[model samples]
Target: MDTPQRAGHVAVIGRPNVGKSTLTNALVGAKVSIVSPRPQTTRHRLLGIASFPQGQILLVDTPGLHRDQGKSTATAMHRWMNRAARGSLEGVDAAMLVVRAGQWDEADTFAYQALRQAKVPVVLVVNQVDRLKDKTALLPYLAQVSEGREFAAVHPVSALKRKGLEPLVNDVLALLPEQAPLYAEDEITDKSQRFLAGELVREQLMRQLGEELPYATTVEIERFVVDGALLRIGAVIWVERDGQKAIVIGKGGERLREIGAKARQQMEQLFGAKVFLETWVRVREGWSDDEAALRAFGYHD
Candidate 1:
């Protein structure tokens, strides 16, 4: 007799910069979600489909759960991101409470509380274990976080290095009800190519820009056309002020060109086709806080 296939949704919940997107990409075997060192890099809830011989995991990658204080302002974007993270709990078969291996804070507690309220099985994922210098501390840290907490299982993994995922996957699969694969094995994510192209461009923005600029910026795909074996994409990088646009454009537009080049390379790799990506920076004057602007920029439900 063979084990039955299990398929279901798993909400990837965590605080900012805890490697949720990296874990989702590792599981799906593709870069379905964008990641940046900056908090709130993920503004929308996207699904990454990871298929295995025994089961399939539908990962809902969300923005990091953080309070509206500190470096992040209480803008409409922040509110939207928080809503997106919380809304992911609904209809999930299980939840992965992702946190740093050696650190647990109030934000992590807040995420755990949110998952508890969801009433679904929570698998505590202690991510970024590779970065821990003191390996002996791992046991104590794990014990500390797991104390008085209910977790179906706890696994330490390095999503970037693709370490310790097999056991984690097995444990998570066991929690799911037996069913057939929800998506085709070849399918990686629920987002379309157009949306991904915009995200790739935004990923470059998050990677290359300075501290505050990336947060103040958003990308929109104005054009996505398949020209034979190539994809021609036009992306508009929206900024909150004219000064920000000048900074993004940089000296002799070199900065914008570099951003486009890197984004196009990522697009080519992900799409497995040639990509011609053009980017332009435009000022929207406080678009981050304006509800109408956010909706127009494709930040709605």
Candidate 2:
């Protein structure tokens, strides 16, 4: 397919675990963002470019919007969400408000309210239809939202299953104004190699840690050096408390070793080079809420 000369930015904003990252990967036709079942898995604003037949769409996958309690990592993540949303929406040609199909709650309303306040041309993307056994049940909820609103269009899609995405892409491209491509044709994402490597480690850690540890942990790549055929990396995994650190390290450091091996393999595939990854766990007492620590770890306000 001939690449479309026209292009514009499209911001994907939604609440936690609503498949925002999944939809981003699907739309971009690449794994630009790490996907996990856990909420707030995305901590940074990731840019993924989708080159459609009609045009290239720069999809800015923002962190999920949520209320913060001024304590813990959740608050820091919420701040990141606000920062990404407020920063990226300016002068964008279009926006997609992604919400889970069957789970219409107060958080969805908050996301909608924020989008409405942005005053950008918005499209409501109802995602995760695969989870709904009775797909028709979503109609009433859809109708309730559609009434007296200025949504460019409402699209129900399954981001994970790759269903109903073509229409969404078409609608987003149609809304975009004619312009030059914002990024290079070969570029799939805007995050650095180190950032992607750290995220891959974090993704593996999230899966291993499950519900109890995913929210409390933050992975940072301390060192990355390429030596010919081998890529050497050092990363530190930060947890809120000493007990959590023990949990991550596991019995005789077996679990942490497993996590490192899995992440290194994935990093090798991502960089197309052999990887030597070294990871260690650290207990940073309330590091999530500490302004200096958060900033140092790349969680900017």
Candidate 3:
């Protein structure tokens, strides 16, 4: 007898840096979303298509759910991120609430409440289990979290090490309706290569920069030209101030060069083509706070 096929969207939601993007990439078997240690690295809602022999899962990777507190955190960018995170729940067949192993806070609770309000099936994915020092604490923590809340399934998996994901995927697939694949098997994500190129450069900025510098910076792909088998990409790194620009460029342009080199390597690996990436740092002056500027930087929904 032939098994039924199931396919639908699953919203991956969590607070900042809970490995939501990592889990999406792991399930899709590709880097569809850029990852960094910094919070709110994923500013857009992205679709990652994960295929199995019996079913397919369309994963919606969104920005971390966060509160805009005080003057510092209250910016147009922050509001947009919150909206992006909340907006992902719409029409999803299931919601996967990702949380760090051994830790649950107000933000996690808020996300769960939002999912409940949306009335979607919630699957609790406790990510980063490999980092837990005490393995004995896992069962107790799971029991404690499951006491008050209802979850269709709960699985402790390490998104980075790719452990314990088989059962998680199986259970998530069962939640969807029986249907054919929504996207082609070869297609891993809905984002274009041009959009991904900018994200890769921004990922480097987030990783290489220190403190709050990465938050004030963004990458714009000025030119993405396909010349034969090679990709020629030009990126403009926008900073909020002149001092930030100088710091990003570093001494004698070494830092900017390193950022470009690393980003180009990632782009090549993902696009499967040789890439010539050029980057320039420019001052934007409070672009993150200005809604008009945010839209110009591709932050619009």
lDDT values, one for every candidate = 0.94, 0.85, 0.94
Query: Candidate 2 residues 108-165, lDDT tens each?
Result: 8788777788788899999987788886788887898788777999999999899999
What TM-scores do the predictions have? 0.98, 0.92, 0.98
For model 2 the local lDDT of residue 12 reads 90
- For all predictions, the C-alpha RMSD in Å is 1.6, 2.4, 1.2
State candidate 3's TM-score: 0.98
What's the TM for model 2?
0.92
Please report, as a residue range, the 10-residue window in candidate 2 with the lowest summed lDDT. 68-77
Ranking by lDDT: 3, 1, 2
Per-residue CA lDDT of candidate 3, range 42-87, in tens?
Answer: 9999999999998999999999987667666689888888888889
User: How big is the positional error of residue 143 in model 2, measured in Å on the Cα after superposition?
Assistant: 2.1
